[model samples]
Target: MSFINKMLPNVSLIWPDVWQATLETLYMTIVSAIIAGILGLALGVWLVVTDQNGITPHPVTYNILDKLVNIFRSIPFVILLTVIYPLTKAIVGTSIGNTAALVPLVVGTIPFYARQVQTALVQVDPGVIEAAQAMGASNVDIIFRVYLREGLPDLIRVSVLTLISLIGLTAMAGAVGAGGLGNLAVSIGYQRYQSDVTIVAMLIILVMVFLVQGIGDWLTRRTTHV
Candidate 1:
């Protein structure tokens, strides 16, 4: 109780800022996630479809996209941020805020999510896809209904993974003055030696990760049947 009392004042003073940072983090994560999810899913489907033995194989296209995805994914994100800073500045008109942070966040996450989507889609039953094709289903129909539907659980699982990763990336965005819990921890907590603040920020991030994991598990279970 005494410790709680001692902490209350500081908590009260910082809580609003913390909450704001959290919201900024969430905004960046969600916006980027949605964009990445859609584009990555399409890219993943393209990768699969254009592979040597796929439904519509195209060696050249597949190889190109494959190399592109690999190349982007290979770049360390810290370097990616600096590499894309000009694009970020051009797009957002400033390279140092939550909005500007979205550029690298999306670029970093898209390749990751695309690979996950490819893996998940590949795991879908080929027989099911064949059956859909036999029924004269269009390519789009087979993709959405067969590939996506069958891969829902894995997609959710990977999405949870991606979202958690984005949280960490958002923190890194703070390096460019994109304020979030990461920025708060680094700028105020670490720089000022406010251990309590750092601890609290870490705890909050941990709680958020666990919550996302729990939701992913529940969704995966719900999509599966005994």
Candidate 2:
């Protein structure tokens, strides 16, 4: 207690709020990452499968999905939160809490991650895909067994990048009343001139980002086949 007070004088005063805010940020990051991962993976796969040279080529579908991804990825996340406020409110029944923030977070992350997934998938050897096709493997088999399996390491790498970006986004979300460290730092710490509080929140976020990067690197190394 004494040491903590010495180390985080202002933060110790509001330890409970800091703890709660940390939990909220984690909640937003994990939940949004999951939903975005699944959706992004599916979207990325569709983009690949519909490409003119893909196993099930459909240029029209590919172009549409491609353009949509580009459009979404072009929007800045902070503006996205406001642009999608009505949708967020509709989905979560309010547009200014942790849960509501998930909508924008997921939406903002999906396009970026989808592109990463696409890049990772496209790196799989075309010859390998061809051999799989020759063996009577269905598109599903090629996607899951070949593309996803072979790209796992790269996927993990990009996912780490995406997740780190998402953590920053969570802070931005917090700035807009989403209830996280960003909110703690911005609303109270910075605004109230509590530099110690701001520093504590920033340090916690940095630790989390580095931890994610370390874990991601370990997973990538373990999964890499070549």
lDDT of 2 at 128: 96
Worst 10 residues of 2 by lDDT: 46-55
Q: What TM-score fits each model?
A: 0.94, 0.97
Q: How many pairs of residues collide in model 2?
A: 0
| Candidate-wise lDDT, in order | 0.86, 0.94
Quote the positional error of residue 117 for candidate 2 in Å: 0.4
Clashes of each: 0, 0
Q: What RMSD value applies to candidate 1?
A: 1.6
Model 2 regions lying over 4 Å from their true place:
none
The 10-residue segment of model 1 with minimum total lDDT is 4-13
Find the candidate with the highest lDDT and give its number.
Answer: 2
Over 107-211, each residue of candidate 1 has an lDDT whose tens digit, in order, gives 998999889888888888889989999999998898789888888898898889988998888888875588878888888888888877777888888888899
